[model samples]
Target: MEPLVEENKKLKEAMNRSEKNIQRAHRERDLVESNARDLEYQKVVLSEHLATVKEQLRSKSEQLATASTQLKDASEQLEKLQKVFEEKKVLDCVEPETAPQPDGRPPRPDIIVKRCKTAWESFKSFNRDVVVTDATHALAVVQSHYPATDLEVIGGGYAKGLSEAKTQRLEDEVEDTAKKLAGDTDLFGETNGSGEA
Candidate 1:
C-alpha cells in the first residue's frame, strides 16, 4: 500500500506539469494572434498614408508645370520687348541730313521742320505701344502667375478639424487599450486558480 501511494503522488505531479505546459502554450498562441492583428492594422494604415502622399505629389507636379509654362511665356514676351527697343534705337538715329537733295544747296527750312515733327510723332507712338501697353500686359501676366497666398485663410479651419479628430482618435485608442488590459488582468487572475498546482 505504501508503494502504491508513492506512485500516485508521482502521477499527480506529472499531471500538474502537463496542465501547466498546456496553459503556457495557450498564452503563447494568444500572444501570436495579438501580434498578427497589430501587424494587419499597421499595414492598412501605412497603405492609406502612401495613397494620400501620392495624390499630393500629383497635385504639386501639376502646379509646377503650370508655373513653368507661365515663366516661359513671360520670358518670351520680355525678349520680344527687348527686340522692339533695339529696333526703336536704330530708327531714332539721324538720316545723314538727306544729302542736301543732291542739288549742292541747303534743304528748305519748312521741309526740315516737317521731317522733325514726323519723327517726334513716330517716337511718341512707339512709346505708347511698346513702353506703356506691352509693359502693362507683362506686369499683369507676372502678377497673375505668382499670386499671393494667405496661409491662415487656406489652412486655419482644416488644421483645426484635423487636430481635433487626431485628439479624439488618440483618446478612443487609449480607452480601448485600458479596457483590454483590465479584461486581460481579470482573465489571468481567474485562471491562476488559488496558486496551487
Candidate 2:
C-alpha cells in the first residue's frame, strides 16, 4: 500500500507539469498572433500612403503639362504680334512722302494747302461764270450780245488750269486718306496706323 501511494503521487505531479507547459505554449502562440496582426495593419497603412502620394504626383504632372502648353501658345501669339508691328513700322516709314520728287520737300504741307485753295477758287469761279453766261444768254434772248466761245471756255476751262503737280497731290491725298481709314488687324486687335498691342 505504501508503494502504490508513492506512485500515485508521482503521476499527479507529472500531470500538473504537463498542464502548465500547455498553458505556456498557448500564451506564446497568442503573443505571436498579436504581433503578426500589428505588422499587417502597418503594411496596410503604408500601402495607402504610397497610393495617395502617387496620385498627387500624377495630378501635379498633368497641371504642369497644361500650363506648359498654354505658355507655348501665348509665346507664339506674341511673336506674331511683334512681326505685325514691325511691318506696320515699315509702312509708316513709307507713308509720309506722297508727291513726286520735284514737288517734295518745299511743297509738302504748303502745296497741299495751295491745291485745296485752288480747288475752292475754281469751284467758285465756275459758279460765277455760269451765272454771268446765263445772264448774258437771257439778255441775248431779249436781243443782247455774247460770244459762244466765252461761255464754253468759262464753263469747263476754269477747272483745267491747275498745275499737274497740284492735281496729282490732291488725288494722292484722297487715296491716302482712304487707305488710312481702312486699318489693319492683328492678334491682340486693331490699331490706329501701326499694328501694336
Error of 1 at 3 (Å): 2.2
Identify the leading candidate in terms of TM-score.
Answer: 1
The residue ranges of model 2 lying beyond 4 angstroms of the native Cα positions read 83-89, 92-95, 98-106, 109-197
lDDT of each: 0.54, 0.51
- Candidate 2, residues 39-139, lDDT tens digits: the string is 99999999999999999776544333332233333344456655655554533333334454573545354455556556655654554454444334332
- Residue 34's lDDT within candidate 2 is 100
| CA error at residue 80 for candidate 2, angstroms | 4.0
Which 10 residues in a row give candidate 1 its minimum summed lDDT? 150-159
Candidate 1 regions exceeding 4 Å error are 94-197
| Clash list (residue pairs), candidate 2 | none
In candidate 1, list every pair of residues with a backbone clash.
none
How much is 74 displaced in model 1, in angstroms? 1.5
Best by lDDT: 1
Candidate 2 local Cα displacement, residue 183, angstroms: 25
